[model samples]
Target: MSTPSPSSSEDVRRTRILSSKLYFDVPPSKVPLIYSSAYNIAFLGMEKLHPFDSSKWGRICQFLVSAGILDKRCIVEPEEASREDLLVVHSEKYLDSLKSSMTVAKIVEVPPVAMLPNCIIQRKVLDPFRKQVGGSVLASKLAKERGWAINVGGGFHHCSAEKGSGFCAFADISLSIHFAFVRLNISRVMIIDLDAHQGNGHELDFAKDRRVYILDMFNSEVYPLDFNARRHIHQKVELLSGTTTDVYLKKLDEALEVAGRMFNPELIVYNAGTDVLDGDPLGCLRISPDGIIKRDEKVFTFARSKGVPILMLTSGGYMKSSARVIADSIINLSTKCLIEMQGEQNTS
Candidate 1:
């Protein structure tokens, strides 16, 4: 079979996205947050090998419910991104590469996954990732309708069109922005990535795209040290290891101010990775839980003040305490009126 040209493939991808069911109508009764039980990954003790709390996605929702902040019925569930949906950003060759267990194992940083049957890996690992991708895409739609939205499980910032690593298996951030561009009629996007790790995946994907502005603040001493990706970042805040919360927040204040002066985005994609929390072995920063809460608040406040719609993705942070921290931050957002919960909207 003759290989299809890049333009033809691009046309095919645009068609697939136009016909996708990922952007379904959410009820007024539900909040603009997206998640699904399938977003979690666990199989035969395999998830334990990595520092990732594979179940963190589900646990965050659980805490939100138990804390009386969110009702279970008000949470939005997202469908899995079908193969056609993934092809929008990932090349067919890269999708074919994922059929290999070794490729998936390396991407997830879990060696045991390579020994398992590909079927098991697909069902237990990749399925959850696809669901998260769907949620990320849907979040853009929600953000355009509501003032802000959040995807409880996405931010695969280490995965590009042709590569996956650092526990990221798909380029969900890229997919989200593409969906926004094509579906939501959005032109400008600003990515505020505070994941404690450089978001090389989206940076490489949008390297030459002028419509997207990237503000990446990450630990300088960590993984996926891609200097090539750094060039793509519009505003780069490289924090060193053991950096404290006070310094981190001050840098963010300046970065946000500078970014505002640089680009006025119609949409803001916030990669709120809690790995910067102190004691996260991989993140290597010393940001405290309150600092994380404040960090999220600052970002949301900035977006709100600018009258820009924002969507948050819980990208990287897999510690046992990560769930509670995330839930608490969301609650803080609601508490501070940065975001409106279903109950709050109804009460108002």
Candidate 2:
């Protein structure tokens, strides 16, 4: 079969995004923060083999609820992204490749998953990721409408249209942006990817697209070291493995100033990955819990001051303490008036 031209594939992608139900209207009672119970991945003991905290998404919400920062009833639930929705950014062949149990095991980096049947993997693992993808897409719409929105379970920045890696099986970030372009009428987006690992997936997807400006700050010594994708970052900030919070924040301040001057974006996509916490085995950075709070504050304050709608995705922090830190950072955002919680009238 002949490969489709870029323009033809773009047309098909636009059609899929336009027809997706992921961008449904959220009521006033429900917050723009998107999540669902289905976001958690729990299966036969296979999930235990991975270092990732599969239930961290649920735990984040649990902390928020227990702390009285948010009500369980006010949380917005997202529908799963169907196959048609996946086609917006993912290729048909790429989606088909996921049918193999070994393919999934490789993407998620879990050896035991390769032993399970594809049917079980699809139902238990991939389905949760699909729901998170839906949440990410819906978050863009909600952000455009409400000035800011948060998806408690997204920011799969290591997956691209044609490949998956670093425990990310779907291109949620790319899918979200495409949905915003077609459905929300957004033209310019600034991606502030602060994950400990390089956001190679989205960088590769938007490599030549001038509509998106990427500001990525990641540990220089990490997995999936893609030199090709590094070329796409507009403001690439590389940190050492054991960099302290002070140095990290200082660099971020400088980077944010440069980013603001370079791109007048209509939307800001903030990938707030808590993996940079001091004890995270994978992240290797020495940032404290307070540093994480201040980091989020700085990003939200930057976007708010620029008058750009910001969408935050909780990405790539699966440590045991990640949920509590994330919940605390979110609470800090609320207390500092950087973001309004659900059920409250949005004054911004």
Candidate 3:
């Protein structure tokens, strides 16, 4: 898109329309059962993709498809990621290493991780992130052009710039934010990662950036074993396990309020992880489904009220089939909220 010059008071009267397309792009084979051989990679191991199961996401999308919740909207069919897109955020060496199931026989003895062909790895890591990043881009684009839009697949917040961790191969929020910031020249992006895990990748990548504000709510002792966080320019909250939904929501409210006071966000990335649900073997915190909806509703409402466009990304949820349930909740809330935004604009 051609970057247009910012406007003054006269331009305020000519607000552009936002988009209303929610993207759902997951490859058929990519969404496999967590324990299947398809999920095994050389170094990534047999762990379920983060906390949310891909099978569940696949199932939920299918559910949405069957229910006709997703019909006649702008849809992005899954496509293999380009080397350029990967290069935008990952190193060439790492990208090459990811391509070859085995690393160059040199320095350290590489672990016996499942050796996924670069094509496979690219699909596993890049496919999900691309949908998320591209979805956000499209959503943000549509909102600017129409009024509002959404991407059904996103919230891959655990991903960093260089490597994959917590099942995240790449940083969805980072790439999307950078794409918008550089291409569209929109500054002040606010990312709210309400997953049960820390937005460590965001912290790792943009903790010091003056333009990005990352607010993460995660239990310190979850996966990756690196819970020690030094509050770099970003807001970090460590929620202890056994914390009730009320306490968690209250803290989230505080953080959202604080973020509002500090940054007038042009765009928001919301990582709605469902691992917080009870019985989620991976997540430490316990947030019921209803609680999650309530939390999501409040956050979406707050962002809309502030006139900040939001992009939803499904980050982590490892409760096997329950991944679908969690993802469905996020999609439902986002779809409803976006439709409401459309309504408000029409009324005005």
Against the unseen true structure, what C-alpha lDDT does each candidate score? 0.94, 0.92, 0.58
lDDT of 1 at 217: 98
lDDT of 3 by residue, 1-348 (tens): 864454542142122111212223332222111111222223344324233454454555555556555532323343333555545556666666654544321111233324545565455544455544555545554444333444555565656666555556556667667666654568888878887877777777786678888777787677544544336537777777777788888998898889888888888877777778777786777777778877878777887789877766655666764555654564666477543321111232
lDDT of 1 at 268: 98
lDDT tens digits, residues 195-233, model 2?
899999999999999999999999989876899999999
Better of 2 and 3 by TM-score: 2
Query: Model 1, 1-348: lDDT tens per residue?
Result: 998998887788789889999999888989987889999898999899999999999999999999998888888999899998998999889999999999999999999789999999999999999999999999999999998999999999999999999999999999999999999989999999999999999999999999999999999899989999999999999999999999999999999999999999999999999999999989999999999999999999999999999999999895899999999999999999999877334545
Which candidate number would show the highest lDDT if scored against the true structure? 1
Q: After superposition, how far is residue 296 of candidate 3 from its true place, in Å?
A: 1.3
Superposed model 1: Cα runs more than 4 Å off = 1-7, 343-348
Error of model 3, residue 285, in angstroms = 1.3
Report the C-alpha displacement of residue 249, candidate 2, in angstroms.
0.5
RMSD of 2: 2.0
Ranking by lDDT: 1, 2, 3
The C-alpha TM-scores of every prediction are: 0.97, 0.97, 0.73
Q: Which candidate is the best by TM-score?
A: 2
TM-score of 2: 0.97
After superposition, the stretches of candidate 2 with alpha carbons farther than 4 Å from their true spots are 344-348
